[model samples]
Target: MNNRKEKTFSEVWGEFITSQTAKGVADITIRNYHQVLHNISKYLDIEMTLDNLSKSKFDEMIVEMRKVGIAHNSIATYVRVVRTFLHWCKAENIIFIELPNIIERETVKETYTDEELELLLRRPEADCSFCEYRNWVIVNFLLNSGCRAATVRNIQNRDVSLADSQVIFRHTKNGKIQVIPLCSRMVNVLRGYMAVRGGVAEDYLFCDQYGGMLSHNALRLAIGRYNKSRGVAKTGIHLFRHTFARKYLVDCGGNAFTLQKLLGHSTLTMTKRYCAIFDADIAKNYDNVSPLAQLYHPKEKIKKQSRAS
Candidate 1:
């Protein structure tokens, strides 16, 4: 008789989380795993033994989610996370269920126009409050670097080296350090802000009014309020990243390879989306570089005539 013990789904999930934590996975990612499983439990028995798990049960749970009005994109996200967990289970020889295909649709990414950017970039008056001034600087940083809000929140004063014309992102999505150049213009702006903000090297670069580290929601709310005050309606802080990517590719003609590194994407998959979305950028000066357009520049215009015969 076979003597291997069968592990319950909950036991396996707890083990996976522990393993992932040991691998230094981000806390947010771990939290997402917990949340997704909890939501899945709403539709079916999430604590059943690994042997009872099957793709049919997953499909039924998905149907339940749809009936209850979960966004498709959000459902897609849950599928992705759960797939990772199932893959881990397979690797550990705990259980195996044929995974379903992940069908996700690409949505258009919105970016700020030059006019909107100009409005957000406007400098505050000399007597502006610290929060106002800080928000302005934060907007500038986002536009300049295209960093995520979490990365922005984790910045330390020492991470920015104005004299060296560089900024170091120590807390990236992939948990790696990313260093990017700081333009002289941005250097000057940060220099002025830091002088006024004044704190030790260990202080958060963009701290709360109380000189404490800024939280994620606080950062988003600050940007939202700042945008409304400046008369710009769109308030998604992540749009700054999208805007930066668009401007970097469409306006500045930056290539994808460098942008991939600049954006700290672990792969070209996401970067290629930006390229495909902004593919029209290739036609911006097509006439200037077209081989036929340049080659057809004869000394005299050529015209077609009736057959000589």
Candidate 2:
């Protein structure tokens, strides 16, 4: 009698997702994994098995995704998800195939310039109402603190200490508690907003007109509307982050290590990329700092006189 264990592709995927959930993966991450898997299934439309999963088939799926005009970064994300899943399966002895290590990705980092930020910060009308005040403060907080939208959404009154000139991030992307020092401008804005907020310590710092906590989407949409009205292009919450990273590096002459800490990055790889993006600025600064540029140059007449003598 033949005795062998076999599982369908869907079964293996379910098990993998279950394992990820058990490991305390973020809900958004798990959802993204499920979405990528679903897309793969829809494209392949084949009965997947441990023995039948092949690199050729995966490559074909990638080609199909490209033909449909999927963004390069998105395709890379799909490839990464699939590669991780296949590695997990291999560890579980469900499949044995060489996983693709590299996926073509385009680095399309976007950031707001100082002029753009000035325009955006002034976009909100000069109204002292709760909503207007909150919106202005939100834009300032995002630009000054460089915190993620999720972090901003999760901020509570207790997390902020105006006297200390800092805010505590209870839930960060890396799952680490971080305390970011607030700039004087940001502190002033927070104090003004708090005077109007009038909420308990446990209540969220930012709220809607109805005094309810704001969602991430609410913050995004608010910014989007303001951007559209102001005629700003490529507007989003993450642009604040990119702008912060770039400004931190350029303004403060910060290195990757310090940037990694401030940005709460697990490694310097991404931070280094930010440095690369600002290479032109770095070069211009280098030109000013070079000894040749700093030293006084002799005139051509002096050189000619000295040679004649």
Candidate 3:
């Protein structure tokens, strides 16, 4: 064990970031990794040699984080990122120890209500400024497509096709091109927005006041102000995504398989969360779908089952 080359955690982390950058990982992802590193750094000494790494040490770090009031979900996120980093270290012959999973209690993700959606979707006045019009169109787009704000920000004018009834999403979370069909309402909304947005195909679909790409902070603040103006207290941009998923599964009677494709999830893991969220929908349709219920019709029972067991 002493023969193995010794490297500080920070040194290995620097190498990991460089490697991830070379692999074409998204800027947002790299930033997220940095955030996780910052979080763990507060608990563990990054300058220490990785020779001290062990499951027990990490378990203590997790407890330390919790004692300081870090959220369960946030800690889980930190652990996940750390696990990936440690896995890379293992491959590099730095350390080899199995990590334990954190129990992440699933909380139903909050989404916009019907009332909130109605207020948000209300057509802006004719005299509204370009940003006003654009923000309105973006809300419509987010609800219809359930895309990440980053995806929306990166959408170019050429990605939309009124004739084709679809929009090409080039900059998605999974870094895959997604072709999502546009609803008639969203299509019409985009048509008017594009007319006002007027730029070449290369121009970003959603731009700032100066007709350049909207930064992450710009998009977030814009949506926040837009929601507040519409009297929506829930201003999270991603809530629109949760809202879309819920409405699709429950109101539209959509299936999980198709939702997976539409949401661009590489696996059913994330998509299944939406399914689990709307488990009531499954119960409501249980009789219609259950094979046993379909095969056997209870002859009108002469009398109901007794109250006694």
Candidate 4:
């Protein structure tokens, strides 16, 4: 029997890529996997075969990445991609080596405060220009709906129903359709934008000057310019999504499962992290509302003499 363990890492990776493509994975995701694998191959500095891919080798790679000042999140991504490839190899009967499964990820708190969100919402001055109006509508819509940048970009005029107070997100990150209800404020904003947008042949609700679909870069640049003007740091387009999630949890009493569906997450893990962050905020005020703390002291005094008798 030909030993499958003799297969080179590159050969296994090529097969994995073919499998991923056949599975209909997104092009960008495939590219990311390929890039990470290539980086791993370079870092190992050896002709890595399936048999040589030990847990220690993976650990060494991670240590080297960290030593080079790679960010924790980036290193975590690398570890995840590598582990996935290794598991694929095992499933394909390419290697039987036990692989380490755990990859520590940094707890990144990347969300806007209420004040920052307020500032962002009111950033655009009252101008009648298409650019000004479109930016305002996009910002508000993102905050209200918690839809991703890609989902926002793909929204069509027909997808929104002002009468129903809902908008359907057809092209989501996870390939699952999400229907988000429109708040009254968001509904009013959309109506105003549509009026200024007028009846156009373009299908997309938000479009460029030439009536073309709005690109991700355009949205990024718009947000970037706004951030620059206001001197806001760590404010990206995705911050709006984070703000929406946090606000939904606090203001609307939303739970992890509901947030998972709203955010179109494939799993509840990411949504749970949002819950944790929200819980932390709640913890900060726990002292004032602690049941025991409030019950221990009473505002009204009973008649002590009657109790003694």
lDDT of 2 by residue, 65-112 (tens): 889998876777778888888888778776766757655553646789
Model 3 lDDT tens row, 6-82: 77777788888888899898888898988888879888888877777678878888889999999998898888888
lDDT of each: 0.85, 0.76, 0.86, 0.75
After the best TM-score superposition of candidate 4, give how far the Cα of residue 125 lies from its true spot, in angstroms: 4.0
Model 1: worst 10 consecutive residues (lDDT sum): 1-10
* RMSD to native, candidate 2: 4.8
Q: What residue pairs are clashing in model 1?
A: none
| Reference-based TM-score, model 3 | 0.87
Please list the residue runs of candidate 1 whose C-alpha ends up more than 4 Å from where it truly belongs after superposition: 1-15, 38-51, 64-73, 274-276, 289-309
Which regions of candidate 4 deviate over 4 angstroms? 1-15, 34-42, 45-56, 91-98, 105-108, 126-129, 198-202, 251-253, 266-269, 284-292, 302-309
- Error (Å) of candidate 3 at residue 110 is 0.8
Given candidate 3, what's the lDDT at residue 306? 79
Backbone collision count in every prediction? Answer: 0, 0, 0, 0
TM-score sort, best first: 3, 1, 2, 4
Candidates 1 and 2: which is better by TM-score?
1
Estimate candidate 1's alpha-carbon lDDT, on a 0 to 1 scale: 0.85
Measured on C-alpha atoms, candidate 3 has an lDDT of: 0.86
Model 2: lDDT of residue 302? 39
